[model samples]
Target: MPKKERKRLQVVISDEQDALLTRTAYELSSPERLISKSEVVRLAIEKIARELGEGEHLEEYRAILETEEVGEEEA
Candidate 1:
């Protein structure tokens, strides 16, 4: 089997976002298996895409986009 090639992405988040990511990964981890922050991010990206494709959470997604725009303007 051939190795998979993956592109890298750089994301900048606030302290609160970092804490939330760390906490979520910790909560999802267990003695048998540990969840990494990278896994959490990939899962979140897949979930968001699935939900958007299904026409679900549009309002919440819009709100997030608006908030992100404001945050970027502030930065």
Candidate 2:
């Protein structure tokens, strides 16, 4: 399989958010006692995406996605 390029997302967070993620990851680390910080971020992103996908904005969001694709192609 060809390796896919991953886009990097840079976010500025407050100490509270940082602390929550660190604590959450520590508790959720399964099988392996060690936890990847990225896993905490992914869990949050997945939850948000799932909720938004089922919201009234879902159709509107689809329209935005289509427009974004055209914009990307033009870029």
Top-scoring candidate (lDDT): 1
Which parts of model 1 have CA positions greater than 4 angstroms off?
none
Per-residue accuracy of model 2 over 1-75 as CA lDDT, tens digit each: 999988889876557778998999988887757687788898878876997967846777789769867866786
Best prediction by TM-score: 1
Q: Which parts of model 2 have CA positions greater than 4 angstroms off?
A: 31-33, 56-75
Q: Could you estimate the TM-score for every candidate?
A: 0.89, 0.61
The TM-score that candidate 1 achieves is 0.89
Which residue pairs collide, candidate 1? none
RMSD of candidate 2 to the truth, in angstroms, is 9.4
lDDT (C-alpha) at residue 20 in model 1: 98
